[model samples]
Target: MAHLGQVELLTPELDATVWFFTEILGLTETARTASSVFLRTFDNYERTSVIVTRHHTSGLRRTTLRAASDEALHRRVAALEAAGRPGRWIDGVAGTGPTYLTADPDGHEIALYHQTEWYSAPAHLRPGLKNQPQAKPRQGIGVRRLDHVNYLAADVLPNVEFFEDTLGARPTEQIQLDSGKVSARWLTFTHKSYDIVYTEDRSGANGRLHHIAFATDTREDILRAADLCLDNDVHIETGPHKHAIQQTFFLYVYEPGGNRIELCNPLTRLILAPDWPLITWTEAERAKGQAWGLKTIDTFHTHGTPPLD
Candidate 1:
C-alpha cells in the first residue's frame, strides 16, 4: 500500500459540515455535486482527500488508500479474492480512475486505487513556494494534510489481522486488556507512526467511525486550532494535549454534523526503522491516562459517529 488517499464522511448537516471544513479548517473546496462536496488541504498532492456526503446519519462512508504501484494494486486484489473477500470495481469517480471497493472485517468500506488526478492550482490558488501544492489560506486553522483515521470496531483484532494480511500494514502500537484481548491497534503503511487505527467499540457497534485527523505544521498550530474551535462555537471534545500512545499534540472537536475531527502535530516522530518493534500497553498503563497525565475523558472511548441511543 502507498498511503491514505481520501475518506468520504457522511453528514446529515451538509452545509454546516462543509462550512466547518472549508471555512474553519481551511480546506479548499474543489468540486460539489448534489450529494457530496470534494475538499483538499494545501499540501495534498491529490485532487481531493475528503468527501463530505449528505446522508441520514453522520459516519464514514468509505476510506480510500492509494496503492504503491499498479502491480501492488492487482496483487492485493488477488489476495482479497483468494481470501474469499472479493470486491467490486468502480471507475471514473471524479479525481480518481478505477477503484476496487471492499469492506474490512467490521464492514467499514475500503477503496483501493492507483490512478489519481494530481492537484494543479490555478492562478489564484498557486503557491509562492515551488515545492508546495497550493497557497496556504489566510482563513481559519489551515491544516497541512489529512493525517490518519480511527475506526470503532466490534472486533478489533480481526480487523487488525485483515489489514495486516491483505494490505501488508505493520502494527505500530496496540493496547491489550487483561483478558488477552486487544482493545486497540494502530497500523501503518508508511513511515508515519499510524495511518490507520481500530479501537474496540464499547457499544458493540460495527462499521462506525471514531474520528478522522488532519495534520498541522506545528504544536502551536494545534493550540491555535483549539482557540478557533472555541471562538466558532465548535464542540471541543478533548485535548490540545499530547497522547500517550502516538505522542501527537492533538485537539479533538465535533463538527456541526457530530463527526469527531482531530487536529494534530506529531512533532518529528516516525517509524524510520523497518524492524521497528510493536509497542504494546497493558490496560493498567492506559488507565494512568495521557502523556501529561490528564485523565482521558469518558467520551473519548464511547463517543463515535452515528451516536448510540
Candidate 2:
C-alpha cells in the first residue's frame, strides 16, 4: 500500500502565498531553500507535507506518495517500468530519501518514495500525546494534515487507468456522463473514500489542478474556517456545505497565489468494507447540486490554476 504524502505547489506570488499558509492557514514551516519553502500541518507525520515554490503560474507542481516499505516501492517502480513508463530515481530533497519520479497520462508529476524524516517539533510545539505530530497551533485555520487532491484532466479515463493499474488505487465513486463516459472519479488507497481525484476539464486543459484539500477535525472546524476566510480577505469560492458524493463538509477558498484550497472534514466517514462496491452518480443526480441545495459554483466547472486557453 502507498499513502498520499507531500504535495509541491508552484506559485507566482511566493511571499504572499507563504504568508497565507503560515499566517492564515496555520501551517508550520519546516525547511526552506532558494526556490522553495516546506510546510506541515500539525498532524502530518512527514517532516514536511507541503512545499511552496517560486513559479510563473500557480498550480500543482508535483505530488508524492509514500510506499508502505522499501519492497513496496521497488514493486511499484518495476510495475511502472514494465508498463513502459520508466521513471528516474533521484537523490531527493530535504525531507525524503531516494525518490522515483513519473507522470500520469495527463502530465501530472508524481513521485514515489519509501524513506522520509518523520516530523519532530521543537520543544514549544511538542505534543503531550506521543501519537500526535506536533502541538496544535493556536493560529489560523490550524488544518490537520494534507488531505485529498482533485485534478482537472482533459480526459478522465486514461488518468484513471494510471491510478488503478499503476498505483493500485481503487475507485470509490465516479460521475458518469449521459454518453456513458466517466467525467469524474474518486480513488482511495486508505479507509478514507478518496486519496486522489480526477475530474473532466471543462476548459479542455491537461494537467491543471482543481484543488488541494486540507482536513479539519470536525464539521465545526470547517464552519469556523469559513469565518476565518471572510475575516482575512480570502476569497470564498464555494460552500460550507456537504458534498453528495463523499458527504464531505467543505469550504473552498483561493489563497494569495490563486490556487484553490479546500478545508474539509472527510475523516468522519470511513470506507471499511474490503469489497466496497463502486458508487456511481448519474448526470441527473449530480445536477441537483450539493448535499443540501447549494449549486456547484460555475467557476468550479471551468476555473483551474494556470488558466487554460
Candidate 3:
C-alpha cells in the first residue's frame, strides 16, 4: 500500500453533516449525488478525500487505500487470497480505478486501488502558489489534508497482525497491558509516523470507527479550531492537548453526524529510519494520563458511531 486515501462515512443527517464539513471544517464540496456528497481538503491531490452518504445511522462505510503501483495492488491481492482472506474486485468506483474490496479481522471494509483522478482546480478555486492543490478557503478552519484514522477493534492483536502480514504495514508504537495483550497499536505504510491505528474496544464492537483526523499547519490552528467549534455549538469532545502516544497536538469534536473528528498537528515527527524501533507503552504509564496530565475522557473510550444501545 502507498498511503491512506478517501474514507466514506455514513450519516443519518446528511445535510447537517455536509454543512459541518463545508461551513466549519472548510472542505470544498466537489460533487453531490442524490444520496451522497464528495469533499476534499485544501491540499489533497485527489479529486475527493471524504464521501458522505445518507444512511440509517452514522458510522464508517468504507476505508480506501491507494496502492503504490499497479504491480503492488496485484501482489497484495494475491497475498490476501493465498492467506485465505480473498476479496472481490470492484470496478466503476467514482474518481478511482478498479478496486479490490476486502475486510480486516474486525470486519472493517477495505478498498485498494492504484489509478486515481487527480484534482484540477477550477479557475475560481485556483491557488496563487502554483504548487498548491487549490486556493485556500477564506472561511472556517482550513485543514490541509487527511491525516490518520483510528478504528475500534474487539481483538487488537489479530487486526494488527493481519494488517502487518498482508498489507505490509509497519508498527510504530503500541500499548501493552500487564496481561500481555496489546491494547492499542499504530501502523504506518508511509513516513508520516502512523496512517492507521487500532485501539481495543472495551464495548466489544466490531467494525466501529473511533475517529478520523485532518492535519493543520500548527498548534495555533488547532486552538483556533477549538474556538470555532465553541461558537458553532458543535460538541467539543476533548483536547487542544497533546497525546502521550504520537505526541500530536489535538482538538477533537463531534460533527453533526455524531462521528468523532480530530484536528491535529504532529509538530515534527516522522518515521524516517527504516529500522525504527517500536515504542511500547505499558498500562501503568498510560494510567498517568495524556502528555500534560489531562485524563482521557470516558466517552473517548466508549463512544463510537451508530451508538450501541
Candidate 4:
C-alpha cells in the first residue's frame, strides 16, 4: 500500500506562512533549516506532514508518498522505468529517508520512499492517549492530519492514467463534461475514497495547486474553523459545506503567501470493496452543486497559485 507522506509548499512570505500552519492551523514545528520548516499534526506518525519552504513565489514544491516496504518501492520504480520516465534517488532531507523523486506529466514533483522518521514529540507535547502522536494542539482550529491535495491541470485525463499506471491508484470518482471531456478525477491507493485530486484548469496553466487539506474531526470543528478564520483575518475562500462527490465537509482559506489550504472531515463512506465501482458525475448533475445543494463558489474553480499572468 502507498500513502501520502508529506507535502512541500513554497511561499514568498515564509515566516508568516509558517505562522499560519503552526499558530493558526495548530500543527507543531518539528524541525527547521535555513530554507524550510517541517510541521506535523497531532495525529501524524510521520515526523512531518507539511514542509513550508522559502521561495520567490507560492505553490507546491513537491508531495511525497510512502511505499509500504522496500519491495513496494522497487516495484513502483520498476513501473516508472518501464514507462520510460524513471526517477532519481535523492539523499533524504531532514525528517525523511532516501526518496525516488519524479514529476507528473503536468510538472508537479513527486517523491516516493519507504523509509521515514516517525515523530517523537517533546515532553510538553506528549499525548494523553498512548495511540495519538502528540497532545491535541491548543491553538486555533487544531487540525488533525494531512488529508489530501488537489492539483490544477490543463487537462485531467493524462494525470488519471499516469497515477493509475505508475502508482497503482484506482479512480473512485470524477467529473465527465457534456463534450466527453474529463474535467476532474479523484484516485486513491488506500481504502479512503480519495487521497489525491485533479481538476480542469481553465487558466491554461499546468502544474499549479488548487489546495492542500488537513483533516479535522467533525462538522462542528469545521464550522468553528470558519469563525477562527474570520476572526484572524484569513481569507475565507469557501465552505464549511458538504461536497457531493467525496462527501467531504470542507472549509477553504488562503494562507499569507497565497497558497490555498483546506480543512476537511473524512468521507462518511469508505470504498471497502476491492472492485469498487467508479462514481461518475455528469456536467448537468455537477451544475446542481454540492451534496446539500451549496453552489460551489466561483473562485473555487478558477483560483490557483502561483498567480497566472
**Alpha-carbon shift of residue 78 in model 1 (angstroms):** 0.6
Per-residue lDDT for 88-190 in model 3, tens only?
9998365999999999999999999999998899999999998998999888898998898899999999998989999999999999999999999999999
lDDT of 1 by residue, 1-309 (tens): 899999999999999999999889999999999999999999998999899999999999999999978899999999999888969999847588889999998999999999989899999999999899999988889999999999999999999999999988999999999999999999999999999999999999899999999999999998899989999999999898999999999999999999999999974899999999989999999999999998999998889988887
Each model's Cα RMSD: 0.8, 0.9, 0.8, 1.1
The C-alpha TM-scores of every prediction are 0.99, 0.98, 0.98, 0.98
Candidate 3 structure lDDT: 0.93
Q: Model 4 Cα displacement at 259 (Å)?
A: 0.7
| Candidate 4, superposed: residue stretches over 4 Å from native | none
Q: Write the per-residue lDDT of candidate 4 for residues 8-66, one digit (tens) a residue.
A: 99999999999899888898887799999988889998888988999999999899999
* Tens digit per residue, CA lDDT, model 2, 1-309: 477998999999999999989988799988799989999999988898899999989999899998999999999998899999858999876588999999999999999998999878899999999999899988988999899889999999999989899888999999999999999999998999899999999878788999999999888988888888898899999999999999999999999999999999998799999999999999999999999988999999988988764
lDDT of each: 0.93, 0.91, 0.93, 0.90
Candidate 1 error regions (>4 Å)? none
Query: Residue 137 deviation, candidate 3, in Å?
Result: 1.1
TM-score of 1: 0.99
